[model samples]
Target chain A: MTLGLLVEEAGLFSTVQDLGRQGFQSLGVPPSGALDPVALRLANLVVGNPPGCAGLEMCRLGATLRVTVPSLRVALAGAPPTGDLPVLRSLTLREGEVLRIGRVAGGAAYLAVEGGFDLKPVLGSLSTYARALIGGFEGRRLEPGDVLPLLRHTASSRRERALPHPLPAERDRPLRVVLGPQADHFTEEAFDALLGEGFTVTAEADRIGLRLSGPRLAHAGPPEIASDGNATGAVQVPGSGQPIVLLPDRHTVGGYPKIATVITADLARLGQSLPGTVLRFEAVAPEQARIALRRQEAEIAALAARLHET
Target chain B: MCAQPAAPPALLHDPPRLLLLGDAALTVEFAAAWSPEAAARVRRLAARVAVLAAAEEGIREYVPTLRSVTIHVDPSRLSLRRLQAMLRDLPEGAEATAGEATEWCLPVRYGGEQGPDLPEIASTLGMAEDEVAELHTAGHYEAAAVGGYPGFAYLTGVDGRLALPRRASPRLSVPEGSVAVANGFTGVYPATAPGGWHLLGRTPVPLFAPDRPGRPALVMPGDTVRFRAISPEEFEGLWSAFRDGRADPVTACRAP
Candidate 1:
């Protein structure tokens, strides 16, 4: 019999996601992937899987699973959900065992299994863009009673693996931003508002964008631009004067002006920041942003190297 | 709050601006406004970057709009300044390539249930329904850029006379294949989506399919499209043919 995870509860908005689909942005397909790459990568490393392998991303809430696999290695990370299972450490679940995770502490939870699930990749990824019904398992959220087959069926037990150092999943820190692809569109005072008073994350948060409510950034001329290409974490302010930080599932092009792009190093913080959470921004030079990103990449790499089976 | 700079008159006279987008990408802005000339410039630069991406492992992917090209690169693998220099050094006089362009002829049924906004669109333009349809079909449209949705191309070259602003309030769900117009651009809804455009007609053809062989996008950048009015009967026949896999829009496309 094939091994699988029988979903007892599908949770709020759980979906399988990988690193992202690349090379299709020109075709209007935004790269939909894990919102917090740091946690997902660490979880994968702990499970002795490739750092970017496809895995289950439990958002807002977490799922209850019945393990049908003879032997399965699993790791939990991202959002530090209320669960008895250890986070950032890999452990085995035998056949007939049940795994349950409760409502998440941050905004989301991530669970990585050894080989992910057996599913056909759409456009070279398992990442779900549910709006377009593309990729992931049937390109939609997991429903109750869904059975996701394991990619690898293990016959024997494997040793546990864990990371030596805790990978930071910061939530309260100010998100670092690199200003402009359109910064000049806003008044200089807008910068002060963005970095000074900051914004509060609204309930309208999703994989597509984080809608924030704060002081209006007055436009120099008009709110709209000749719709241009989008980058992940682009903070776009439309005519209403509210800012929406475009995320992983954002449109490939947007009509509003983007004042800043949150740096790569701060995506984890952004991802974990829940609704009503007060968020702040700090402008960094592009060079500085790159250096901060490099440091994070190096740290993650070092941790991945140290990820060993016990 | 976010405000990107306005359309400065100086930007028109100044050289192209290479702006950093976060740490992973850089965008080369050729113009602040959308124009055919700017679109041509964008096409040329995108083609050049495609060649560059082949040689530089750092260049991950690129999305070319009508006025700019945003190239995503790996920070560890490529320096933003070096990439900017490479872009600046490349000659900007390259002709916009139309040699490989395919012009697709689409059949549409105007002013019906699928196009619920047709009456309002015609009345807003102060033209009869047929006159509005005629005006729309009289122009040759080019796919300026593909965004908003996969295979959904922003078809430029709408008849200036037929140009109308978007609806005061967008519909929560615009039907798939609905032909829409707004702010001088025309687009077909690849799937049912929230939209503000004025819908005037409907097409029976599929707009996007991820597993599609060859090019996944039915309409691509620089590709041209022309529409012809069809009876409701024809629309049904085509819809049935599409459902039966007998109609292929790819086969309908020809050399411009």
Candidate 2:
């Protein structure tokens, strides 16, 4: 088989992504990529692909893929939709084999192939930002009957490698944030509400942002600021007072005053949080946040280390 | 690509403040309001940062806006602490490249179906249609920021008299190349999308083209932009020229 999988069913909000499209935000292109980047990395490593290889990012619902390539190494990570496709385990799917990935337990899941996709990079990225219809598998999500170009075929080996799930135990902890590039624009009461309250993720969540319904974050004035570069995970409190945690697909520049920004270490944890899930925020110093990020990186590196033992 | 240290640049009254935006990004904030002074600093900082990011592999990307520039880096390659220290040491006299900008004079056909809200805009401001167009052409605009969509530059420096608020209800589809004004800014909707601005006209030239050879954004932030009113014939000719790939808009519109 020349191509990878023949999609029998296209899941809700499924797209081909890598880390993200980079160095293009100045041109107003939002960097769209895998919601759970850590999962994509782990899935890639387990499948013997580069940690930042392109893979399918499925949210909530998962697609049913029929293997088209003669033989390819595959693995699912980050809240695998179905028990059949266990998290962090690699499997070799041959031609005519059907893999049914059902519903995700959390916000999103990733399915990685050994050599990644044969799709071209746009502006130096394999990530798909469908709004502009740029990059990755025709610059859009996969559809039924769409032939996904698989880059390389792996020799069929019976050795299936796996790693223990690492994020589950820390899932319930509050997501850490670094207080602002615009914290002074918000009121003290706003900070109290943001730190003390548990915000429930609303149905309006997407790769763009997670709309949170929590205590209102009152602004010092009308929620206005000179449009500035928006950092990923910036908790922007607009006139509605609802805090929308900006995600990978967020606009590069924003006019609203940002209250606080979630640390990079907690972004994957935040990504896995599904709608109706209550999440709390904790502000940490940048130094502590760096330490947390380093720890998370260590965890992934260690996971990669255990891959050989499996 | 290094920072030039001739002298401190003008138009900036306060020293830029460096603020952390999580563990990966550090925003260099120039000002809090939308003013020409802040816009100049934003443009100057973007020029320097682009040079620095290219020279240093550690810095990942940087997004420039009207008031700030957010620099992203992999913490492993460049820690936030190192980035902060580097910026603190960067001499702020990079405005030497300020005058080296190309002014794009885009052609637009004003009024009629070409600009549905032009009549309303003129009436709202108590001016005649030609008077409105004249005032619009009289002012200079700079691409202070590019957002909302790819190549959609947030053009600042609209004439104060022509300033108007956006519509309460946005139009479902603002035709591509639609030039509009709202809240003291003039922006051209690069791609047809939901928009709330007051339509002034539609430009024949495109702002964002994927196949653009040199840069992604045609009217990049810090570039100057000027609008020229054209007849229906001129509009039709330029529009088709751009659409059918007869004339390259970038080469045609860029002032020598």
TM-score of chain B of each: 0.90, 0.89
**Among all windows of ten consecutive residues in candidate 2 chain A, which has the lowest summed lDDT?**
A151-160
TM-score of chain A of 1: 0.96
How displaced is residue A284 in candidate 2, in Å? 0.5
- The TM-score leader among the candidates is 1
Q: What is the TM-score of each candidate against the true structure?
A: 0.94, 0.93
Q: Pick the candidate with the highest DockQ.
A: 1
What tens digits encode model 2's per-residue C-alpha lDDT throughout A127-242? 88887778887778888887787887653465878886645547679999989878888889999999998999999998899999989999988788767888788889889999
Model 2 — TM-score against the truth? 0.93
Off by over 4 Å in 1: A1-3, A155-157, B1-13, B91-99, B124-126, B253-256
Give the whole-model CA lDDT for all candidates, comma-separated: 0.85, 0.84
Compose the digit string of candidate 2's lDDT tens values, residues B121-197.
88888899988988888778888888868899888888888778779999999999999998889988888899899
